[model samples]
Target chain A: MTYRIDNLQYANWSEKIFRQMREGGVDAVHVTISYHENFRETVLNFEQWNRWFEQFPDLIFHGQWGSDVRKARETGRTAIFFGFQNPSPIEDDIDLVEILHKLGARFMQLTYNNQSLLATGCYEADDSGITRMGKQVIKEMNRVGLVIDMSHSADRSTIEAAEISERPITITHANLHSWQPALRNKRDDVVRAVTENGGMMGFSMYPHHLKDKSNCTVESFCEMIARAAETFGAEHFGLGSDLCQDQPDSIVEWMRVGRWSKEIDYGEGSAAAPGFPPQPDWFKDNRDFGNIENGLRKIGFSESETAGIMGNNWLRFYDENFGPQQI
Target chain B: MTYRIDNLQYANWSEKIFRQMREGGVDAVHVTISYHENFRETVLNFEQWNRWFEQFPDLIFHGQWGSDVRKARETGRTAIFFGFQNPSPIEDDIDLVEILHKLGARFMQLTYNNQSLLATGCYEADDSGITRMGKQVIKEMNRVGLVIDMSHSADRSTIEAAEISERPITITHANLHSWQPALRNKRDDVVRAVTENGGMMGFSMYPHHLKDKSNCTVESFCEMIARAAETFGAEHFGLGSDLCQDQPDSIVEWMRVGRWSKEIDYGEGSAAAPGFPPQPDWFKDNRDFGNIENGLRKIGFSESETAGIMGNNWLRFYDENFGPQQI
Candidate 1:
């Protein structure tokens, strides 16, 4: 029952390397859509998205990027859906929402830690609770099937979105503030709001992402995850594990700076956060929770709970909200 | 003993109007420097401000904008100095704190009504709580001399600003929310915070702005004023009628829309407000309590309290916060 899912991927990922996903035990890749169409030429166009489907065949892609996942499905590409780390690409265009959703965007984080035209991002200098546009976006998202993600947004903006969003939101990737206390982490209210609203919460394994990465272990991640599950009731929670298995340090730097766009940085000289111990398998070792099974097992999740933590809970969520179109 | 003062206006307006004021029976004006302005404006924009001295020679202008007021006073303009609103308008630009303090802009309002880059505005969609930016704004405003204004901001933003602000903020132009549940009005906590913080509260003659304007008479205005004064200590309350005279219906509609460029509304479309029939001079009728003077009488206020409500209370506030600078 513990269906595994890794919620995101970067632009430079390769088809040949991900062939082991079947062995990696990941059931679906919840891929985010990029505003930039030229994603490393590999994921450059619909052709790459189609190629991934042809190559993996059984692999399911939950798209956040702009891909006709269903169209790909018609061409035998497994369900590649769309997601957005920030709602900016949608801009003020709510109608584009239906077009994107129909084109297959499944998840959206309201902001990316800075002020957008819609709301203050989590990392922004000012945390204006939410903007008029943010409110409108949430309502529209509910009408469409775009899931709200609070992973990188500020607590105030996230909480506001949670209260306003009719459909439960999905925290695509976050840690517990109690465990990590990083800006990227979620507060108890945020998790409770999301889960209480019948949404999903995900835990990432960026050690630098955890509080004391110096002492961070899988146990810490689990403790954070389990605590939130206990607080909001376990059924509403799951894992995203923002597992950037092979993303380079440059990409990491790009992520850190690019998310905010504003040049004002307190950590101008500091390296990218929660840096990994230089393991031989640096990419897989530092970024992911673990290499598949060992990751959850080391995190001390019971098999059934681990199942829920992996993809089962997400599958159930997808089924309840958008799966089967039974509604 | 009933001294009249306007709690809001730019710094030099006093000198310009002071000559006319002695004729009109006006004593002083609570001159506000916009919190959003740069320090250079306060410090360098002295020539025009100095012109006020020659014009109104005897009229006193309370400097609520920032530090430039001190310099203005030093150069011979009598200043009752303080910051009028909490938000520095510099927002997360905390560095501007000392710079503006050096310029003399002190008083601030936590927010306007919708959420700002710093805090929630009075008319926000939800009254969640003090945001991180709001909390920071309060601390900085207090550290400096920014007075927090809660007249047109959100309830939660007001509450948070009150609790968090080091110095007490005044409800400079608010009616009792108990009388009418408009966003511009304040609650009992407002009374407590201002009084407790040793700040002042003021009543407004904004009949059109009151919650139940249709039912509003001078009696109702008096009731609201008295309730707030009593709830807080009378000593901590004052009169800031927020009276804007000589504007056209278009301007009224502009205020109604709550925006300079955008025209949204202040809520409650149909209500009896002070209008042309009784007009500005309408309150002159009832000597016991019907007239503005009578309204004070109906409240059973002593001459001192009457004077304070009439305007002296605000005078005391300005004189207290900014007067010590006078050699």
Candidate 2:
């Protein structure tokens, strides 16, 4: 049976959202656990999730390996896979790569929206590629099972990570820049590097990354996927959505500024609208996942190709990458 | 120039010990910072040491590499190297091997007189060579600069660690069982395995490991080293006085029992005499290091050989083993 897996989401998690996931048949979701928190703070976030797992056993559970996705499907529940949108959770320590992996973190982005110790962010004025610590950390990450996510890293850093990492790295959430020229959207060259290296690209449904913001329809999004499929195989694509449903403006401010910046960062937006951009109506929440699936099929993707783009591809990638490297 | 280095000591550190080390011309000392503390607790211990380093800038400082020992000599101070007598600091996580090393922990015993997650301690009746985690942790430790110390581990675990580690592992503090047959002492076979595999064995000067406990003479202790030198090669031997000076009896109880056991464990002695044994007269404190030097000369070793046993051998071993492996 084809399973639905959202490779990325940062929802204001609650029973309502989890129920919506069940309604949409979301077998698994890679949820953002750490945005800019440090190691200790990230641990607190994990502890909170632990409480959630204990309380909401029927709706969702922690996912450590790819097999958990299948288990979630069998149990008619969603498997919540933890991920970090920024490497700040590890601070400057390379060893935390493995420690955080053991703590159930499956994915970590090299940078969020500014330069980090590991790599330069997409918003940085100058891209210095990967730093000295980044190379060692990449090796450590490879040794363990933590998947490197380069969603918000600069062009040079993202490409460098893709090349340096022995295993396939991922861009868990971002649209193709060629289709929508947003700072957060990855360029065609970056997409090619990721796909050619057997890595993944999860197309985002966040309004900022869409061609016409909130007005973009399912036809336009699916057509873009069709165009992307010709260049970078459909097997390499999946939905991330970058969904942040029902979250207040304050949460968006926290995600963008974190603790690193004193001044406000109007990322991908002007001072007038600094919070999270509204998601397209076609895919506003987890319940809308089926809309994209139908849109992909209508755009002339084969049945198997549409299945792969929906969630089967992510499951296959997870099976291949979500464990310690074979000795 | 010859430098004086003590391979082991766990004093209730104060200005007095620093002054005594200066008087003894001690250039470097490996100091135990943890017994059964977990990672967070160990970090607190490290923070405490950091305060000490700042307070006594002229007397002691943290030593990360062998060069720091030389620097200590040049500055007329002691380089205090950090170690753990148990693997508790990492708390079953292999990743913390590099993190603790980065935090200045150069040595970590796989076990401490009881079974740990990694290995069987000396006190365990059945010795399982090395656990699955033990092997991976050893590989990680070898990759980083953290020395795999099996000083308090079971014979099988100790020997297996020496054989498995790519780098020269060390038994930083212990005595030959053939000389004293103490519970904590290593048998001849264990010593041979270590020395044959290019590892270092620092003979313990703790009274319990001595032939006649506190009554053992300097002559007898030096004679034991002389015989060990003939068997295991003098280049592999050095001093690791398991000195626990000025620490109260309560601390000894904490070391032996920790949180693992509520029932009191006498360790090297019976319940009637459970506390730490008194040191032999000739080697009571850091200032008494010269007595061992003289005793080695009295026991018919060359001047260079005597120097090696006293500290030079450890200095050489440190120079070779204290950094990340050269690729």
Candidate 3:
């Protein structure tokens, strides 16, 4: 049973997208529920999702465990797993790690794009690694089955997270810097540190992380995945997409600045293009997943390996890591 | 088996207090875990209690249901039930009613001596009764089994809450206005509205609510209880000591001021006595519960009625109200 999953997406969600997921045969998606919202604000986000689940029960449902993926497949619906791009949802409270997990958040990044209370973000000049609270939060997150995601963290912090987490840590959405040279992309050593600790990496489809930005070809994307698989094993790779479908440029501004700056931060975009860049034509939305599948096959991935890259690896990882660790 | 439950207390809790509860044969306590804290700060308070529960497992455990009282009695430990003295923990979000309940909150007052989003507090000059959000929150609270508490609310709002709530609400800690006429005390009509709707009132031992402040006699307190029982029935009454044992004046100041006021508005105290008033000699601490038991017995109350007032009545209320409502 090949299960298609996108481990990261922050779409301006609608029924159209839900239908597109079904059209794409995507069984589950780990969706960004919050970026810089505090605990109360994040809860309001969860409440919004609850309303969505109720309003569109036949199209989507809340996904808490791997079994929910199987259930979604059986029911012909998409399972929406919750995640955060920053530790801001937990605020400064380490105990909120468990609380947020109980509220159905599966992934939490220690930093977004700046120095947080827990760790240094990739944009920071100095890489201070993890702070005292970061270590404590990591242990609590491990205990409570909230996966540590260092997708936007500094090198030292990401490496330290991979080592400090008793459970495997993930870089849920990023490519290799060796391939794209993007600041948001992971370095070879960071990827190796995570993958060697049995963690997974989800290749990003966001244009900034690609070789030629919006003009990057499907062949090139497939070749990049092939290279990552060759280096880090296919089981450690999956799709994240980072799809921001239908979201306006103001959303991008919010993502980049997020009350952290009074002035705008361009992030990966330049001053002239300070907004979400267009996706490569071939991978436009959920329905374009098939294009990548064919690209993988044309690039000579075996059927099982393609299945693993598509979703099976993440499903397995979810099964193992989304619950309290066995004593 | 008679259960000894204090339905309200906000003590400066310590090992000493827990030991004193055991010495007094107290099985359960609905303790105020927050006064004006927002959701995240309230969670920090919960975490503090969690640490205490861990540190003194033999002395007390987290109580979520009436059965915990029985468990406490059998194990010779006290069960600490969590409550909030204000609606601030929910912070204008109706969904947090269930979230806080899942986190073990059993009681939440609609207001705390100032106008709130939910209702008018005693100190507020205008009584607008239940707000639009308050009505929705009441239904959600009923569905989730977080009891509506109107202890610090004004007359119109308290009456409105009793009418709006499908489940029985509570005046967790206050005395009768007819007995002492304090601003915080419930009027006879307010008490009738709650009691007639099957709600319970926990008689307070706070000096300001007593007949003669700190010098009020045990006999007078017991006689007042007798009069209340005669008027509202014994089953609707229990003890809520309002015990601020060992709390410093600063804590009392915080309780009264919170972050709402720039100026000191000494609630239940005058400018000359802008702090917690001294408890009557007869009821100074948890260890003094025995004195109330003796006074109740000496006031010509039957054993069953005395037992009910001591704790059995609250035990019954907990059994009926501490979980999700029946479909």
lDDT tens string, model 3, A1-327?
Answer: 999999999999998999999999999999999998888889999999999999999989999999999999999999999999998787645668888999999999998877665677787655656754577678888988999999999999899999999999999999989889999999899999999989999999999999999999999999999999999899999999999999999999988877544356688988998988999999999998889999999999999999999999999999999999777
lDDT of 2 by residue, B7-100 (tens): 9999999999889999999999999999978789899999999999999999999998888988998898999999999887876355688889
RMSD from true fold, candidate 1: 10.0
Candidate structures ordered by lDDT, highest first: 3, 2, 1
lDDT preference between candidates 1 and 3, better one: 3
lDDT score at residue A155, model 2, on the 0-100 scale? 96
Candidate 2, superposed: residue stretches over 4 Å from native: A1-327
Candidate 3, true inter-chain contacts retained? 0.00
Candidate 3: the clashing residue pairs are: none
Q: What is the C-alpha local distance difference test score of each model? A: 0.56, 0.86, 0.89
Task: Return whichever of 2 and 3 wins on TM-score.
Answer: 2
TM-score (C-alpha, index-matched) for candidate 3: 0.53
Query: What digit string (tens of lDDT, one per residue) describes model 1 on residues B1-327?
Result: 465554553322433344444443444445444433333444544335545545554555535432433333354443444443434235335556655656555456655544554566665565545654455556665665556677767766666676776666777767677888765777776667667877777666555456455346776677766776666767776655554444344444433332212323434343453222123444321111225656777679888877776666766666555422222
Give per-residue CA lDDT, model 1, range A176-240, as digits (tens).
88777777877788777777878887766555466565356555556666677677776776666
